[model samples]
Target: MDLWLTLAVMAGAVFLFVTEKLRVDVVALLVAVSLLVLGVVTLPEALSGFSNQATVMVAAMFVLSGALQRNGALIAVGDLLARIRWKWLFLLVMMSLVAGVAAFVNNTATVAVFLPLVLAATTANRWAPSKFLIPLSYISQAAGVCTLIGTSTNLLVDSMAREADAVGFTLFEFAPLGIVFVGICMVYLMTVGRLLLPDRGVPGSATADHIGRYVAELLVAEGAAVIGRQRSEVLPDGSNDVTVLEILRNGAAVRGDDVRVEAGDRLLLRGLWQDIDATRKSMKLKFDHVARDLDGDLNAERLHVEAMVAPGSHLIGHTLAGMRFGHTYRARVHGLHRRQLGIRQPLDQVPLHVGDVLLLDAPVKAIADLRIDRGLIVMGSRAQRKVDTTKATLSAIVMAAAIAAAALGWMSIVASALLGCVALVVLRLLDPDEAYEAIDWRVILLLAGIIPLGIALQKTGGAVLAADQLINLVGHYGPTATLAAIYLMTSTLTEFMSNNASAVLLVPIAIATADSLGVDPKPFLIAVAFAASTSFATPISYQTNTMVYTAGNYRFSDFVKIGMPLNIIFLITATLLIPRFFPF
Candidate 1:
């Protein structure tokens, strides 16, 4: 009865998490607490996961990755996208490189670094960022599945493999299958599917002149002229050029056009640059001129410092108001370069989040002083000369060399990565304190919380029982069906949850099922890893996908329109390719 109940509870938790009814962190904690309280896990066993070596390794990697990112050691190879002569070939080459790099780094972090650059490239090359962003995100995820240290999934699978056999996965164990699969994907994405991608409503943006900046507000005064108006109706005299971006009334994230312009509801608008003065005059709109140059007032007396929101900063959650930037740091909140969602949004109203590159144009004197200050790590701004290029190159080389060493079995990926981190610090690529902020606790907690549940499932004989049922259902049709089923299930789960968690859950099942069938487990394991990592569907599906989704100013439907077909294509290919390569 306890076993059945436990299975039921676990299934329910996964379902709830997939449906997003409860927050993931909260769900993870609930599962951990329930296990401890019910005695399925003793206090030590339950708590032990938090301090697990795998969890620490994953966390440490983030900080090390951050060190490289803050110092600009990592440049988006997507910047080289302009080199491609053909558009389709360009998309393919870009995605391939991004995915390949993602295999060694966090895909989300990889996409975050590239989002601005991709946006800039699209503007430079007369292409839509929406098309490249999602593709790049998906590629990075796919690439991450290529190496043991590429993603947390590889790490989780390695840990599970060690427990199963004395010979665990080496770093390059995945390279053979990964290279083949990724190669096929690259060719297909470049040749066939690139033409199918949507050209979203984005235009070229070389200079500031390319952007539309207008000041129009929802007039909330009593008996105001623009009350109870639709988006089109609120616009001035049917020009169709002006737009109402948002209505901030009473601190709510609402989507309403006829929101009844009550008192205190702030309005946001965008329009043509030349018409801006006339429109503001005609509508009698009052808007703060945010695009004004920082050369005057306040900046002349002080230093102007710029910092990209380094990974794992204390500044992630708090707003400028809550952070007391003016009160504590003696740094005035000046300009910002924030991606409110994916593309650039007005920084004035932006609720600050992690990885936001803030253009802190302050006084010139304080600029150099702010460079190594505790919180804000300076990334070279537009006018700022590329500082310490030699150190940056050295840091990048160190990271790459460490990866190469780990992959070749000179040291554990964890040890190699940590050594690389130490080298980065020693070389002064990233400050010791700044490195600490780069670790994402949420992802680490998710890993720590879910690992024990996988163990519990194993202890309860759940994996074998599940395998037996799967065999009964699909074994007669043969192992091909079984592998396909496993791939599909793993892929669907990865799309809905974290790829690492999905890989962890499916690895035991795949190995168990393979043992039952008397076939090679490597192919099945590879299928699980690959399928779970290639999430091209929704922004919410993966971290990297989310990074680009907002930065490109993309609609939710855009990913579906772009990735759904690509996913189908990959799914069909995996079904055929897995058996041919490894023989299920």
Candidate 2:
């Protein structure tokens, strides 16, 4: 009964996670509390996850990541990479830099720090962002196995191992396998992956080479052929080359479908400049002076900029129309860039979420005011500000010290990260309030909420039940086959659920299976660690993937085309190498 109850709850939670019907953290909290309410776990067992050392370490890493970002450290490093003249050399240097940084810092933080840098570099060098952003994400994942602190998955695995009375991994124990993975990734990207990467960024860029499309207002001249037509009728039957987004009747915005075309009506349309020019001649429509002269008016006293919605921003899950964004912030919303979708939706109707970049026309004062806003991180601007080099150097020193302390066994990963956070604050790299804001509370909540479920699964014998089922299926195949099966299953689960959640659920089962087979548990545990981080086949599998998804204007198939082979390679590598490293 207990096993059935636990499996039922897990099934429901998995459904919620995959569908995204509820926020992930909210789903986590629900699952944790539900286990307690249903008598599956005692109160203390349910609550213990909140105080876990691994969870605390993740929180501290967020603060350290914020400090480095604020102190201009990441930007300074990116500037040097951007100076590389050779394109191939530039890719090598950029990937190496990302991988190296990611090996020490959290992969998500590393990706966040480099995202804008990659975008800016591509813009400056006249290269498409698609050529590099996905590689940046993939390399970060490859290097995340370098150290215990490289990813939350490693820490969770170590924590689970310790709980099960198995040996825990040292700081750099995974380095051999991790280094090999990084080498394979570097070679594959510079060779095969480069050819598969799409040139989507250039076409989706705000400054496309051919001026493919622009959001413009056009005045409808009197007695045009399409005067009384509905907006849909104007572009009917799957005609998608041009779109009528909005209509202005007497200077008041109206929906394109609702409004009839009047003699002097103004319309907001998105299309190529050449198409607009041709339409103006045929339909007798003239470009609105205010829209055409955006540079002279909109940006004269204001700054035209792009800003990404940071995780846990108040803007998530709300539409600009509902927020009255333009009136509130005095910023005109031009468009929104979303993963896999590009800028296809109307601005007002589009819902905002984390990692969605907004193109805004706001006064310079508003932009300055928003610079410190926790809700949004300004990527770059037409007018740039100087970075504080002194703070950047100090921040680097503080991070290095923390890493050294952990690697040298002077402190645990949690202690080292907490100490680093304090040093960053004391050194004024990030203010106390800024540090508080920098911690992604969603990630913390998600960790705290789902961790108890691991305890529940073990205590209720669900893990053992699941393990027996696995053993019955794969026991005769030998330990090598068993390890490969576990790795593949874990990797597949990660694509549909949070990597941490998958790790928590599967790690216990892997340990139990090892015990059942009378083989060493270390090999199984190591397989879980590598498989959890090998989430390359889909963007939803990993946070870093989602971070680059929209920036590169990638399709779901793009990840499949580029990341699937990488996933297969890692699967084979782990299956072959894990047993040799920790003999079973």
Candidate 3:
């Protein structure tokens, strides 16, 4: 009866989590508290999860990731992407590279780094962000399959498995399935998926709704004043927004701007419209009005252009009317995408951020002058403002040392990462307030609340009972068949429950299955490990996917159309791959 009651309460909590009725963190904690009040678990056992090493490790990783991003460590890698002559091959290789990195880092960070990169890459080629942005986000989620530390859900499962059966998955146990799954995905994305991907960014946005319009490329004519000037000095007021989005020399796109601009070089300047014209009129520069004309009708001839609020862009959490962007930049207010649904209103009142694309209209001459200020991206071009990286060396060194120490096990991964955060503070690499703002407290709270409930389930013997049920259902078959059964079950559940919560629930069942078979638990455990982490069947399965769903302006069928096949691929790979690895 006690076990049944425990299961019923947990079922209710999961139902709430799956249906999105209550916040996940709230539901997780509610279950833990209910266990105590209903006598399902003792207070001490329920609360013990707060101190679990796994929770601390996950929390610490979040902070470290923020530190790295805040210190500009991840963005610095932007230089590594080489120019590709073939767009198809370029997209494939870039996807592989992004996936490889995500194999180690968190998925959200992967998206964070690559989202803007995709936007810049495609927009430069005159393709809409839609062609690659959704794919990038999708592939980044798939990257979690590559390794143990890649996703928090995986870590949570490993931790839970260890407690349940005194065993857990090995570091590379996922590689066989993951590599094959990623391989098929790569081929699909490069070919069929690419064709299926929408060829444009979202439209019908308010002034700031369309992002492509925000980025632009300009040409430096002969005898320009900035020809001999470095970015720091040429930047108006030394403001950070000024970015040299891209450079064209002799018809070739150059990623580096440190090279002095020569006569006839096409310059992609990411700045305000006012500065663009100021430079063109003041320095005798010209606009790539041809490029600008593609995304939207911006006639430098007529003196008008467009721009948007980018993801992680300084635009998020700020109102345009409050900041008086029009008054300060001398550009006319236009349409905004504004948060859709219940939050739908004009962008003039909406706060902007990294995923939002906005549309703006202003004088052609003013657009030309505004192009030099870095905080903005010209709608159709990829340009970066010159940053003073001389100080970046200190921040970089601190980050590297932290990673090395953690990887070498000289200190705990979380502790080493925290040390890097302190180093950033001492060096003043980023504002302390900025660092705090970057942490996603909602995710942190969700992880914290869910972890304790997992402890309760384990302590009350509910996990064992659940596992016994699964074993009895499938134990009649061989271990391999049982493994597939478990994988399928977890995958189906994850389509509704969160990947993290699902992992927590399924680990015990995996252990019980292993016990029933009297085999080395690694095989069954590996199946659970992989299954709980991959949820491509639905958009709501993972929070990261949900973020992309809204930003991409996609429908439920979009995920069903693209992600359903990916899920099928993962299931087959797991059923086949885990057995070969752990050898049940």
Candidate 4:
């Protein structure tokens, strides 16, 4: 009964995670509570994950990542990126820096800190971001496996291993395999992935050219000649090559081609510069117009900014008309660019999703205000401001010391990370409030909640049942076959679920399979660790993948086109190398 219940719950949880009907953290907590209600795990076991050293270590890493970003430490590297002129050399330098930093920092944060820099670089060099953003995400993932601190998934695996009374991985234990994967990925992207990536940074697309090319709502004046005319009469199909996305009547989206233009009706239009000008003159529309002050300061004082909506932003699923965005922010949203979906959609009616980039016309102050707003990431076209070298140097020193201490066995990895975080705070590199804010509560909650599900599976004998089934199918093929099977299964699960969750659920099974096979558990554990981090071939597969989704204007197939081959490469590498690293 317990095993069936556990399997049922796991199936439900997987379904919820893939469908995304509820927030991932919420779904995780629900799984924990369900385990308790089902009597699958005791209260202590259920709550043990929160008190685990690995969980604490992961939290501390978040603080460190936050400090590095907030202190402008990582931004300092962009200075070197500014000097590269050749495409291959540009990718080489960027990947080298990304891999070096991601080997210690969180991969998601690594991508976030470098996202703005890459956007600015693409704008300056006249290159498409599509050519670089996916590679950035891919390298961050590949290089992150090189160190225990590179990604939270590694920490979770190590912590689970320790909880099972197995020897945990050392700080640099995974570096050899990680370095090989990074090198292979770098070569593949430079030679093949380069051609597969689309040149999406087109002249009129907001992802590339964010200025002047806009889709705006235009209100016809009370005396305009187009009033009372059929929408077709005013905005005929392909008229001036301008597409009328929607007509807002009484603040609700009405038909664009069929409805008549009533008084106060707003028309949402998209077109090129000349087309917009032609349509404006022919229709006598009154679009959003910011007037210059008596001193004519509008052009100089106002700023046009393009910001991508972040994941978990309150703006998701809410239409701009419902949010009163213009009233609340005192800004005008000139355009909306969505991934997969083209710009022809009606902004006032279409619900917003994470990664949708909005172009806004606002004062310089509003642009600055967005820095603190968690809802958006600013993709600036202008050159980035100089990073504070003092803070950068201090942060680098503290980070280096922490890594050295852990590697040298002078302090535990968890203790060393906690000390580094404290030093960041004490040295005023990151303010106390900023440090707390730097932690992603969703991740903490997800870890704390889903970890119990692992305990429940083990305590309920579900892990044994799973191991037996897997072994029954592949045991005759030998332990080598079993290791590859586990790696493949874990990799597939990671594409549809959290990598951390994948690690937590599979580590015990891997250990059980190894023990049953009369082989070292280390190879199985290491294989699972590497496979969980190999979340490629889909945007939803990894956090960093999602981060670059809209910024690169890539479709779902783009990931598969580039990432599937890389995934195959890593899978083969892990299978062949694991036995070599940990003799079976």
Q: Model 3 off-target regions past 4 Å?
A: 76-85, 168-177, 200-415, 418-435
Write one digit per residue (lDDT tens) for candidate 3, span 82-126: 355466766776787778767766777666656555555654544
TM-score of candidate 1 against the unseen true structure: 0.76
Clashes of each: 19, 0, 69, 0
Q: What TM-score does candidate 2 get on C-alpha atoms?
A: 0.84
Top-lDDT structure, candidate number? 4
**For candidate 4, lDDT tens digit of each residue in 1-584?**
88788888889989998877777888888888898899888898778878987789988988877777766787668878977888889988999999998998888888877887887787678888889999999999999999998988898889888888566899999998889989999999899988888887743456545422446677878887778887667774445667777677765677745678876777877765456657777778875443223223455577667787775456777887789777666677766665443444446666777777787778776666676565677877534445788987898888888889999999898899999999999999988988877777777888898998888777778787788999999999998889999999999999888888888889989888877888888888898889899788899888789878767767788999999999988889888888887789
Compute the lDDT for candidate 3.
0.62
Clashing pairs in 2: none
| lDDT value, candidate 2, whole model | 0.78
Off by over 4 Å in 2: 201-306, 312-314, 317-324, 327-329, 340-351, 362-385
Model 3 scores a TM of 0.69
Q: Using TM-score as the measure, what is the rank order of every candidate, best first?
A: 4, 2, 1, 3
Winner by TM-score: 4
Computed on alpha carbons, the lDDT of every model, listed in order, comes to 0.64, 0.78, 0.62, 0.80
lDDT: the better of candidates 2 and 4: 4
